[model samples]
Target: MNADEMARELASLGRRVAALEATARPPAVPAMLDQHLDADTVLYAGLGGWDGQTLAWQVVRGWDEIRSAPADASAGVLAALANPTRVRIATELLRRRLTTAELAQRLDQPSPGQLFHHLKELLAAGVVHQPERGTYAVREQHVIPLLSVLCAVLDLRPSVPWEDS
Candidate 1:
């Protein structure tokens, strides 16, 4: 072959090799199917959080184990959110840490005594914590778990609205 023709063929071959190299690279982390198990297990994962902070978690458990879990053990946590006022407090805390006064104001409470009444339930349930002084927030680890509980309840509906929250 002529010299120019040989050069052109070499460039074409190089391009094909580069394309192959790109496709041969390892894939990114998988977002689902954490294991090959098709059934008998469950996985709950979440990403995103209030503010710029991002959060993620993946909890896996055997269906049998989940079924066997004691309801009484978590009944307090569930009970904490049962009240609408407490629910609002928990959701606001998930958004950001807030002092008692800030929370009461944001929540529109005329009585600080009533606000503390609600905060007491959350603190006892371990869903919210006081990081410094009176400021309260949902811990990083609890964010996903809290959301998981809410999502489970929301799923109970036959057709939950797209923007229910």
Candidate 2:
């Protein structure tokens, strides 16, 4: 064809190639899934450990191809949230890092001894962390996201709501 027409066609082809490259490139890593799994397993396969007898066969089918279990946090976080005292303790800890006594005082229902008991339970659940002797805080990076998911799953909500005038 004409010289001008050939130049226009070449430019259109270049634009198409650029668009194709953009579509082919992978997007940025999702924040929710990053650091949530082991480096090698992050892109594919779940991070799970189970006893030989305890694990169901169907669950592990195609395990090699499965990647990261679709962002559901560990079971330990859910267990920690089951207890009311533990949940409150986690909330208080999230507000500010605190010593055992500070957490005890903040929890209205539980006595000091009871609060200590709950703290121990939370520690085992991995939903709370002890930075130093007697100091505790919510395990922010991991447990917070787990709690967010749990809240959505259980449909948790405030007990009272303001009246709309």
Give the TM-scores of the predictions, in the order they appear: 0.73, 0.47
Runs in model 2 with CA error above 4 Å? Answer: 1-73, 153-165
- Per-residue alpha-carbon lDDT of candidate 2 for residues 34-106, written as tens digits (9 for 90 to 100): 3435443413221211221111111112444444444344456577677877777876765668888777677
Residue 122, candidate 1: alpha-carbon lDDT = 94
Model 1 Cα RMSD, Å?
6.6
Residue-by-residue lDDT tens digits, candidate 1, 28-86: 32355646765788888877645565576777889889889899867989898999999
Best lDDT among the predictions, by candidate number = 1
Which parts of model 1 are misplaced by more than 4 Å? 1-30, 49-52, 158-165
Error of 2 at 136 (Å): 0.5
